[model samples]
Target: PGAVLDLSKVIQSFPGVLPKPSFGYAIAMRGGAPNENRYFIDGISIPTVSHFSIQGASGGAVSLVNLDHIQGMDLITGAFPTEVDDALSGVLLLEGRNGRKDRWGLRATQGGTDYGITFEGPIGENTTAVVS
Candidate 1:
């Protein structure tokens, strides 16, 4: 898996993040612990951003988020902001894509497990609905 895309490889490219040889995609950042880093989508915290091997929790190979679904990424390091006081090393914030509002849409995700179908449309005049 050394041929991952630039977006998936960007997190380890930061100045203080060190890439380990045997930890899959795991990184030790800012001379801190490997599990010290945190990940968030929108404003909700997730267990990890890396793809799992299905039966175990040891991740770090490839990321779970598709590059096509990302709008932006914020990698915060140092300065210990008061809002996010849990992390000791850094934080990775990911903004997911918001599907088109002009019309209904369907997206398909394949691999790792069974096929996943997502349907999105407007539930009301100002509210959008999505089901997966």
Candidate 2:
């Protein structure tokens, strides 16, 4: 409904995930508290995925991860494997994409509360880089 495409809003559309009754984007999964969930990017644990997150909480008004850079996402609710630690409610895994090696590219985006520019290209013989 707005210019900003929030990740939290998208997550709210999933079944068994409910948005917090109050402000911000904190979510409860399978009747569990929001803080019981965990977030990860490229197998690395991330404390919070939202901007202006609370001291021990995991959500805010906006997401810190850019959707354009994300290649895939996995949402696991309950019965987590050994690799996912401290997840009593759910786990959100974000997989990032590598930059294009064939050529350089640039993109600019304007949102409701922020603006961003992304650049991607080859950094080395076989390595690529993406900066936003």
Number of the top candidate by lDDT? 2
RMSD of each: 4.3, 2.0
- For model 2, residues 28-104, the per-residue Cα lDDT tens digits are 88889888888898999987778886655558867777777778998888778799867999899889899999999
Q: How does model 1 score by TM-score? A: 0.71
Model 1 root mean square deviation, Cα atoms? 4.3
User: TM-scores of all models?
Assistant: 0.71, 0.88
**Candidate 2 total steric clashes:** 0
Measure candidate 2: CA RMSD. Answer: 2.0
